[model samples]
Target: MSLKSTHFHSGLTTHLIRRGSLTMSYPRDPNPTKETFGVGARWDVPAEKVHEVWVGNEGCEYVIGE
Candidate 1:
């Protein structure tokens, strides 16, 4: 199966499910760092956090849902 991937910006609240390994970085913070997520992992990004996502070479797939 082909892997799917997407890029996300800040100012939105949503749920993310990881289909592959990926990294999330908080650029707006004083100390920016990269957080990695594995497959089948659930992540919640609130409107307050200013961040972006980086999909790995293997590709990261996710679904947005309530």
Candidate 2:
């Protein structure tokens, strides 16, 4: 009795939020270098003051209307 096989691919879900994805990877070079994500926004100003700003030199990032 000998059965041992391991080659795997099955974990993809998007816009469905069971693990909501913009593509993530971890299975030894399944292709994903670095694609980070984090954005939060809340603004009507005059509440801690910071109106419009922008900065994205590495890839993309925003926390506008601080």
lDDT of 1 by residue, 1-66 (tens): 133333444566554656776677777778888778777777777656666777777777777653
Candidate maximizing TM-score: 1
Q: Model 2: per-residue lDDT, tens digit, 2-48?
A: 12222322332222112212222233444534232334322232332
List where candidate 2 sits over 4 angstroms from the true fold: 1-11, 15-24, 30-32, 40-66
Highest-scoring model, lDDT: 1
Cα lDDT listed for each candidate = 0.66, 0.27
Off by over 4 Å in 1: 1-12
Q: State how far residue 15 of model 1 sits from its true place (Å).
A: 3.3
